[model samples]
Target: MFAKSTNEKPESIKRVEKVTGRLVIFYEVDICNKSELHKIFKLHKIDCVIHLAAFKYVGESVKTPLAYYVNNISTSLVLLEVMQECRVKKLIFSSSSNVYGNPKFLPVTEDHCTGQNCTNPYGRSKYFVEEILKDVCTSDPDWRVILLRYFAPSGAHRSGLIGEDPLSEHLNLIPCIAQVAAGQRTKIKIFGQDYNTRDGTCIRDYTHVTDIADGHVKALKKISEDLFKGWTAYNLAAGKGYTVLEIIKIFEKVAKRNIKYELFDRRTVGRSWQDDDLKTVKTTKVVGKRYIVLHAGNKNGFIPGADLVFSSSTKNSDYHGEMNQAAKLQNVQTLLEAHFGKEWAQHDNLEWYKNILKGLKDSENENSQDQEYEEEECNSLEDEIAIHI
Candidate 1:
């Protein structure tokens, strides 16, 4: 399939490389350009194409509806035209759960009505594109397409090497959580906690990225078979839903620390980017995998390589042990250690300081005091105590 941008193609290439030992060729040509697409199709012996290139920002789609429609809808038309000309009749198109919109019923079935609840241009784009593909496949019997509708994809490959890496700002919840845990972000923001779901938070089915990738392979296999003909749609979810609160709890458990989060009542820039479908993976169960665990002590959070390197450098210093311990305390501790060192651990009255910290910890545990601690309190403490240490 043709990618819209050059930067995005490298990731697609790497993912495709893992499955096939044979040299897999990837070209960076905008699918919106028909002439470029036609030339590429003529060059490759592509039996069937899996079209995944699309502009998928829901909020941005709302602001620039035309770009969303043109990029998502128009690009598909161009790809189909090229395929038709090249005599490639089979295609596996990437669809989304957003087309279903706000679920009329919990655990939405494929037969459940579509296009009615789509809240934004992005959802509408997917809905309209699916309709276009349906018409294209129906009008011509020679055309066979499989529409794979995906849910929230998270968790990199077990190796943690290859996965979704948007070059700019992140828009997905998984990456956002990762950033917070890695300490890149100060706090995790839970957009809505008042949704009519358990825990009052928006719930979503988070499928592992590798599992979703394997679904692509399964669809490709179906296309290779003579029995798999005509157009069909399938929902690729984990067959479950997870509330935002539960996800935070899991991440905190995995990272071995508390994750600070707050409920956002007004900041509803985007509603839950999540979905469930009744069309289960009965025909094509992804082998050797079934469920994803938000495991404890996984130590995965917003920590980037730079932070790791900085922390490691402190560890190698003569005072490494104390620095490492300080870094592990929290984001505040890491900042303190990096700036002030062990002196921050000192106090005019060591016993008084320890007692105060202990009391604060106790009050927080008892949930009696609702006072929020300022980052500045611990921010410069290290520097202040440097002479004492």
Candidate 2:
């Protein structure tokens, strides 16, 4: 439910419907807008919501921590508040393997410690939402929620109608390698090669996008059942890990060309980290009574503060000035406690934010379009883009 953002390229809502043959209703509205979201709940009877929206880039989160928190966390809170008023309680939140942070073991589990090792604002924001959801389920028995934490989402559907189409060609490994193969880019910039693994490239659990979608469908169906309640999370992954060089070799064989790449120092690619070498890295900046999370990572994997704050991550001035936006972050939680002190804990704002994020876009976009289809009282479809290959 978005059509505005300097940094966001939200996939068209109509295009996904056309390819999948599913009845769809779309609204080009930002989730940050409270009234727009509430309008949706007033118009429909949404049973379940699969929230798959967020500002996902990890490096960008470091440069602009406040934007990430506001968009990913605060915006979610607003959505949850609206959903509760409408009494639509079932939710499926799109979480990430990045929330697992540096892997303490080979195969990461849902029970493995979270929020502790999160290295970036993007990951930290996800962790924060998960914690919020857990608290929500605790306070309310009616809430049924499932948090699906996934790794590298790759491959396409069997129909070949929809697939991964990144806004930036170099954003992810599969897309970046494809750009190099298709001659859209000069060479792939391999983040690092000094890891304690074979070929030294990063190792990750690459699952098909269809499987990830299927996982969500399964969770939705499960939660819809009477027996399901509270919060449960699972790792939607292949369990086996593939190194970057291994993936490139497969691409080389298929494309019949040597994909050239330049090696840089180890940097956190965010997800696709399950190896032993990766550890929690935090960059802290103290500003008066408030402390801003400047960067999150280890010596090898974290983005240098010099490159993050003063320099550009996207090479565009608008995207380059993320740090500038970060300076204006509102520490709502801290400030609320500072003035209201312990009285703040009794407020329902925490509960409101938790449940709202899970169904924010779905409730708001129910009748966003002029010619939206007839659903009696149902809001349909999430906005997504498709690829042809």
Candidate 3:
């Protein structure tokens, strides 16, 4: 159990508070300690646990293999044991793409071999924990474990308030890009360029961290079901790969400025060993019929009609039922048709309308405090109308 640090904002706390509809509590405890973990769990009704704590540095794990093992594997073992003891069966684990080692195929499936060529202890630790969970499920029928292997995470919570603030001074590419955009860094670094890729650089799939968080919530929704009662795993990825240079270009476009960078000659460790061969795995898609339908709608230039209606309502309505005189519903309809396509017209759902109504109602509630409401602007939340509404 971890509490908010000085780096976390009041908005992050408020966001969690609003969603859960309760006063969020904070706890400080080492999960590695069995008694402490059990004590905390016993104290509260933990309907779900999303484990996001782990030593993540690939290079550092190579140098400090023992430390990595002790931190990653040992802590996980302790937590699992405590969960078992406390009868808290639902667990959503944070796994990694590094566990895949060098992928055998273009798009690595869940069945793809893992722990084969994991270059470092950090990956191996995750792999070991996964195996542990698999065994735990095999031995016990009550436990529910969902191991979600994550790709690279990009972007903040959209409020710009809560972003990845790692303890280490060394930054990941997206955060580094953000820093460069903010004028904190003079330039970015292209780690390796001469590798065998479309652009002669290592390619990776980057998923938004908030998307990953939402995935945990999604998994939690299924944990109470029979299908996901035992051990199950899913890859939480963006289903597309972007080269370093391409990402930098996107950042440049987004920030409306050129980003400076140079190629370095460090030994490539993860996917490829040499500068000549840049290995990459194509990202995985959401393997569901509904997802297939949505994909078709997306390609055909149609979104769920609810998205259009809700988007129109948000911009046109003045807080309540009152409409904005300057805002034209037809313009909003045109914008939605252009942006979401004909799919919005095809689909029939009022869920998006319901959510907008909920937000509006919540915004109007007499009990809701002005201080309790925090400004949150999330582009991802735009798609919130997709399936729900």
Candidate 4:
């Protein structure tokens, strides 16, 4: 219930606060702020922490590599240090399958080597944090760690009371398809249609957010019961892979609408820093209560956030040194609106621009670029989102 952005969907927080009363404390505080973060930790008798915070977003990470490293890695370190001070011993980390990169084997297992071929900066950041956790576990057998390396998560809650409210600019498959059905855009663009998989598109294991949450509770109980020490990794996915087209078809059938789409060879675009999972919520089912968990083709792999925070990450600082988040967002939307009709661009632009990186904010990386946009004619929202994939 702690967050920095007072503007990142205030209504959702309001709704939660309304029901929880004083049981759920909401703090609009930044974790990077040692003093503020510590103050909150002091208030609660926290024993175990779920470390799910980090900067994500593949293309943006590539554009701002250092931002990814500092936000994803440094912030986790800071949280850990605070946990140690507060005597929080057990931690469940929200890791990502991106650690496996372009998987060598189907249904990637926990043993798959990571950080070796991570092309995306976001993936590397997660891999590095996993390493840090391993070091922490090895250094102190008292520290119990469980790394949940989950695949792409989708679906919403069953109650439909609280659902995902992702910024309009970037969305996962379901939301994007939803947009198309609503006529937000013309078509869906499949990232790749010629992969080795049967459907030719990249195959990803998707699980419902509810299943993932239940799995964590199970993991916590398991860890407590066994007194397990050190590090253990588990894949929390519906041990099944679905092609982009397969998902589109399902949505189309359910919605009873023709989701216009176009298959593209690839895309070349630019985008920056997205943050974490300790306090992250996976993607919620689009609507209602009771998210029916997808039964995976592999029963063994079946597994499973509001925030759609693949990794519960936060940039320690704005890194870009831009205090005018409101102004910057106006610029991005003004720019996107020109290309993507008015409704085409609606996500809160400054959603990810919070906290300050301190020393790194002033320093510039060689790969970093100014707010620049390369324009190409795009008809569908899919083209806008998938072009950069």
Candidate 5:
């Protein structure tokens, strides 16, 4: 099998090779470099391409939009140009549900309008690529493409060898919760708690990363078919939404650990209080009480804090984070199940999350052992003095 690596470490690639039991011919070349990318096409006989190279962090995209645009959009263009030059027409593009922006209706389908109100550059980039693919297919009937719009992929591989390890800050909800549970972070910051939802928090559909991979495989198979032509999109999601609070509670139950979190007024750029301003408010001591006003793009500003300032409640609920029955109707899941089976599409999110916690614990243990060995190897005056004391 052929692969391209940019940010992936050698250890990660080795682990993947060990698990797959195949030698992955990986080129450590930036996809944006046309010459380097073209060399790979010439070196290997690549039948199909899975285009997953992109800058995907929403908040980071907002902070550095130019980087997002240049990398995400330009890379796709360069890759397409090279692919066309090499006569490689089949593609499975990794896409995001953020292309739909704030959903106008529940249970978003492939037919939902995209590129309308994308909140960040990341989403817009994906939309632009999808449009580009559509145009490419229109121009040439031989090209086949499948756009997989994934919603919040969580969990590691069953073997726990490879998982989501962000190079920078953990911006996503699952990783934030995991950090808090692992005591790496003091507490998670909930953006807002007054949204019009079941628990007054924004709800999102989440699917396991494994299931998303399976979806890609299914898409690849479908695109490779003789009858399959043109470009199509599918939503790879569990089809039901979960509130932020619900996810925390579920994690607490599964991990047997308290996850501390603080709520703040939801504000994203433009006319909103900055992080430094919020820190000042948090540390300030008032005579009787403290009042912090947050402008929510309206006349009457709202208080910055929630009614419940902090919570580590371990309250259990009947909610098991199950997939919505309606999700069975989704085109991707339907197609996957039809070809594989009902069990192929079905996944236990709670169980997957538990596995993630287990992996995190294992990593912690390994780190602890390494630290102990290093301590044993060192002998300092301070250590002797502390021992005598």
Candidate 6:
């Protein structure tokens, strides 16, 4: 498979090579460099392209709007020009639900209006690209494109060899929570807790990364079919929504640990990034077997890897601890001793322990509350989540 490596230290790509024992032909060139990207396309005799390069962080995008526009939009424009020149018209563009902005309705569909109310430049970039692709398709019937608007994609590959390993501070919810559970961070900073949702936290639909990958394969297959002529869009999501606090409780269950968190006044950019009206979606029909299933009570509807133990020898192993024993009581004493230098017993009754216990109790009460209306709304979109190109 052809890919692009932008990071100087592309450790994940190297790990892919090591584990699979297969050569991945990739170029480290920037996608905005049309000549270089064109050469790669011509050299490979490329027939199709999957455009996923973009500056995606919402807060970062708000901080630097020009960078987001230049990188995200420029790369797509360059890639499209090269594709047209190479006569490689088949393309799958990774779009985002952010293009929908604050949802006017629950269970958003492909027909949901875009390019309006986009709260940040990142969302605007995706919307602009989609519009550009639409114009390209209109100008040439030979060009076919698929826009995959993804919700929150989380979790690791089932093999556990690859996962979300961000170089900078964690921006997504799942990774941030995992960092706390793994002791990499002392606590998770919840952006807001005063929204209008049932739990007063922003609700989002999260799908497994594997499922998101599967959606791409299905999109490619759909575009290759002769009947699939014009450009279309689909939402890749679990069709269920979860509050930040709910996810934390679920992660605690899966990780067998207490996740400490503190709430702060939400930033405008932060709210734009995640907080919104219930943002579940009824996905378009992709030509493939359904890969997503939602079990009762599990909002994410997938197995999470928070408790996964990694060997220290693995190149990507950032956090190491005993398997299935990460939060055992004995380990707590060990952790205290390590921190307090053998005088931990004297501070065993410290207020910190009481606060943690209190947090756990508060979390339990929050999770136990039922949002029947929201659950029903999400269930209404379950059957539609089945992908059929």
TM-score for each prediction?
0.66, 0.67, 0.65, 0.65, 0.68, 0.67
Residue 322 error for model 6, in Å?
60
Q: How accurate is candidate 6 locally (lDDT)?
A: 0.70
Badly placed stretches (over 4 Å) of model 2 are 1-12, 269-389
Mark the 10 consecutive residues where model 2 has the least summed lDDT.
380-389
lDDT of 2: 0.65
Q: Residues 1-389, candidate 4: write the lDDT tens digits.
A: 56667235767766665544645566777778888889888898876778666654554676788988988888788888988778787889898888876554444568878877675788888998999999988888888888998777777767665556666354667778988998988888766554444455555677888888888888888678665768899888887667778888988999999999898753222110011111322221111122111111111221120011122123332223343234443444344445445544332221222211112232342222332221111112222221110
At residue 181, what lDDT does model 6 achieve? 95
Give model 6 RMSD, 1 decimal: 21.6
The alpha-carbon lDDT assigned to residue 61 of candidate 2 equals 83
Model 3 earns a TM-score of 0.65
**Model 6, 1-389: lDDT tens per residue?**
44455433577777678767988776788787788877788678776788888877876787888999999988899888988988999999999999998665667788979977787888999999999999999999999999999998899977787887776652788988998999999998887665556676767798898899999989989999989997999999998888889999999999999999998655443332233443542221122222322222122332232122233332322211111122432344444445445533422222222333344442343432333433454555443321110
Taken over the whole model, the C-alpha lDDT of each candidate is 0.65, 0.65, 0.66, 0.61, 0.68, 0.70
**Poorest 10 consecutive residues of model 5 by lDDT?**
269-278
| Model 6 CA lDDT for position 188 | 86
Over the stretch 158-215, how does candidate 2's per-residue lDDT look in tens digits?
A: 7665665666422778877887898988888886675445576768888888889889
Model 6 TM-score, 2 decimals = 0.67
TM-score, cand. 4: 0.65
Which has the higher TM-score value, candidate number 1 or candidate number 2?
Answer: 2
Residue 263 of model 4 has an lDDT of 85
User: Which structure among the candidates has the greatest lDDT?
Assistant: 6
RMSD in angstroms, all models?
20.1, 21.1, 23.1, 22.0, 25.8, 21.6
- lDDT score for residue 369 of model 3: 42
Q: Which of candidates 1 and 4 reaches a greater lDDT?
A: 1
lDDT of candidate 3 over 49-137, digit per residue (tens): 78877777766787788998998888788888888888887788999988888787767678889899886788899999999988998
Q: Which pairs of residues clash in candidate 6, taking residues 3 or more apart in a chain or in different chains?
A: 285-388, 286-388, 286-389, 287-388, 287-389
Candidate 4: count of backbone clashes, pairs at least 3 residues apart or interchain:
43
lDDT of 6 at 312: 34
**C-alpha positional error of residue 381 in candidate 6 after TM-score superposition, expressed in Å:** 45
